[model samples]
Target: MAYCAIAVIVVLMSCFFNRFRPLGKMLVIIALLLPQLSKAQKTVAPLVLNNEQLPVLPKEFYVAAVTDERDDRSAVAWLLPTTEATSITPQYKVDIKYGAQAAIKQFVNYAIPPDKALRPVIVRIKKLKLAESLLAGGRVEGKMEVALSFDLKRAYDNVHLIDYRTSSIYNRIEGQQYDVETLLRHTLEAGLIYFNTWINREADTNIKLAKGVKLIFTDYTEQPEGDTIYYSAKRPLRWEDFKAVPIGGKYEASVLPSIGYNERVEIINGIVNIHLAIKTYLPKSASWVRNGSSTNYSLNHEQRHFDIVKIIAERFKQKLMSEKLPVDNYDGYINVDYLEAFREMNIMQDQYDNETSHGTNSYAQQQWNEKIDKELGK
Candidate 1:
């Protein structure tokens, strides 16, 4: 028994040492090499732009922007035009004709010729070179083009329902000498990030489907007879070519639902005179107002409204696809899609009323019931 115990102890020790010897060696090596490896791995992505690096853009880019010295004490600039000016409702031919001409003339300082009066003005602009100075600190030179093109607003429903009350310039409106420059930098950074995010999402979707979607930034512009800005994929877009247009929020011109076949376009001072043809649809049923207090919950509710709408749209589309229904089945229901969309919209509204307002199902339910009754009657 003593001999057997000694032999078993020796065997256990041998096995333990054999297993731990390599592990100990690996730990020692890792402890010795980790810092060096980390140092070696410190590298930057090639496409990333440093603070001082200038972006390469085309030379012929022309940028048109608006300035409000009071709002942010900075100038407002956009790759797109002013949203407010385009919101001019034109239900009549005279309004459509003269309104468009007036808008174009205000910005471009040119008359929309009677013969070419009906064509949407299209423009394209890009950057020429980097503008470096004590102020800019050797940043990418800002450049862009203003184009006027198609007014598809006339073809789509709800063109005038919301009334393009949201007027904003793409540039920051602070009066500092570097305000515009700063605005340009911010716009470029934000725009690139946004596009990259969109690309990433598209890539993920494509990979799952075993397909790909290639989208390049281009400065494509289209303007027909009057004042139209048409952009396409063929044009090369520079970092400064795309301008950010704020569509909604506090101090917005108006909130309008973008309806079928129509999109309201805005440029800094560009002309796009189209009329609102449809009557505005009031929320008679959904008594859910935006959260009154400026708390995070209120903000969350507003954001949730947007998020929920997107989710509902996706779900509806998925349903349609699963049923093998053509996208055209609801073509006739474009105007009425508002009704269907609101079906899910109320969920967020209810959440807002409950969580944000802390209302005991009083105001929200009452308002919601009214909206429902109105819709049902219609």
Candidate 2:
């Protein structure tokens, strides 16, 4: 019984040693790797940007916002090329003094201001990375890539104006890491100087930088060969132009005429030029006359209606030519003026018909004919 008990104890001790043997090996391996793992994960100190290195621009611009849009925002550069002794790689982060966004903003603000009165712009840092590779003969190669976009800030949105991309390559001895900051500062300065030169050249002619609006009036004229007749001082209305079927109404004759405009916009020398082509037209298919009422007198009254439309078009042109339109909402102001002119056309036509009783009142008709002719002569 004693021998059998000792045998059972010996087997239990062996099983316990086997179970704990893997755990002891794992602990030893972890202890050996602790120092190397910690070193591999270590980060170098952040870079510092030199503000005095930036250049002043000819035309100042406001830096409204700055954003870092790189895919990996955690690190801006990788430091310490792999050597035979140490193969671990370390990352170089943003500037410790100002960080990425703040660093760029401060650099730009040194040359310009944050004032809203200046030309406002936003800067996007698309790519900012510095990479190093160990080369033969104890030399290290450093390459930097930087991409930036400039946008103009408007009332409700932003307009992209320009883009700049640049890359630089340099060679140095293994321990010369200070070139990273110098290279970064010089590259940033180059981008700003490029933008400044571009804006200075473009400010006078680019539509996006227009400061005011201008109005140019033109009369719409076309060949008198189509179904539609464009109003002209020399082309008077004839009785044969009426082609539509006469509707059943108390009036003996009817004419359909209207006023409208076509617009063409162009910018010249930092001014928005709005060209308006005024059109006063009569559609022959929509005008009709009773067979017996086609008298010179009755025709004269219908022509006066057409003349009323032309006069209103002239008045519309005068109104816009006399006022200063805001550049931000010039189209809206033009639409308002057009609507007012349209209402005026309707009221004037109705008043003429009401006073003349549809051309039956002889004295009133005669008075309208003279009034219409006088306005047209002007």
Candidate 3:
């Protein structure tokens, strides 16, 4: 209105001065209209997405951040249709008040309060667009589309949990712009409600939401008929299993054995279940007997070395089963326990060799054999 008034005054003055200087009047009119033309060509007014229209609900997640990732970040909507009248035609750009990210953050917070004691999630606004088309009988049709992805925020990273996308079409009298906000608000509400329902249904079973850890230990018993002998009460080591050439040592015979485990991890009902396959084994190629010294007593001494490895493996399982393991670092804890068990095995092997004098002392050797058999539950 102010511009119109200024134009009218300028035109009146130009007419009054036309006879005195015609070029001056034309220049004054052009000068007066240029500013108005510039203002019209500038960006159109922005539409505010009011959050009050969004209805609150019981939600399982709170919005941590809202990111606008649309290809055309200049505007969230286009209010005016072009003369070509096609869905892809460019129109007057209309932006959300403040910005899309800020406005959506407000909208989500209004619907699901920030103070809610719930899971924290980031919302990626992949698409948020409103377009209008001129319809017959002086009416207009509007389409609003929204695509969003939800991510769970962990300590150092984020996990993509779910995605939501929806589009709505509505009809309104030409120039009735309020429908845009209504549709947008309903779309956002629908997204939030969908997520709430999804989480309620999936919270118990989704691996991404698992909160605790569990362990299931299984003894590895699948041994093929081969040179490697896995420890079993039914399959005691025999002298033939010692096939390696004896190294020049004071001991009559020697055996090489160790303990190890393989782990398989799974998440069920929001718990991380670690399945461990524990094994104690010896390879015939690594165990040897000296010539003319493969007596039952010497063999028993070597077998005790293998038995000590089995005992340590059992102890390793017990150590883990008796304690609560943290979900985030359970592997590290298992490794520490394994290293400790390995060290214990070496110490016990050395002690047995020293006390029995490498099977030389019959009384001490008998005492050691009894201790090994008792521990092995013979």
lDDT order, best first, reads 3, 2, 1
Candidate of highest lDDT: 3
TM-score of 2: 0.71
Model 2 backbone overlap count: 0
lDDT of 1: 0.29
What stretches of model 2 exceed 4 Å from their correct place?
1-43, 53-56, 60-75, 81-88, 113-118, 133-141, 171-173, 223-227, 233-235, 243-250, 318-329, 343-357, 360-378
Mind sharing the TM-score for model 3? 0.66
Per-residue lDDT of candidate 3, residues 1-378 (tens digit): 545866786777677775767667576767877765555533356666676533445545778889898898898777653222444445777787888899889888877777447778899999999877777776667788899998987776688899999988877664344455667777888998888789878877776766778889887776465877888878888999999998986888888899998899887877888999998989899988888987887888888888899989989988999888766567889999999999999999899889988779889989988888898783
Model 1 ranges with Cα > 4 A deviation: 1-297, 326-338, 355-378
Q: Model 2, range 297-363, lDDT digits (tens) per residue?
A: 8888899899999999998988887888866678888899899999999999999999999889999
Per-residue lDDT value at 154 in model 2: 75
Whole-model lDDT, model 2: 0.78
- Which of candidates 1 and 2 reaches a greater lDDT? 2
The better candidate by TM-score, 2 or 3, is 2
Q: Which ten residues in a row have the lowest lDDT in candidate 2?
A: 81-90
Better of 2 and 3 by lDDT: 3
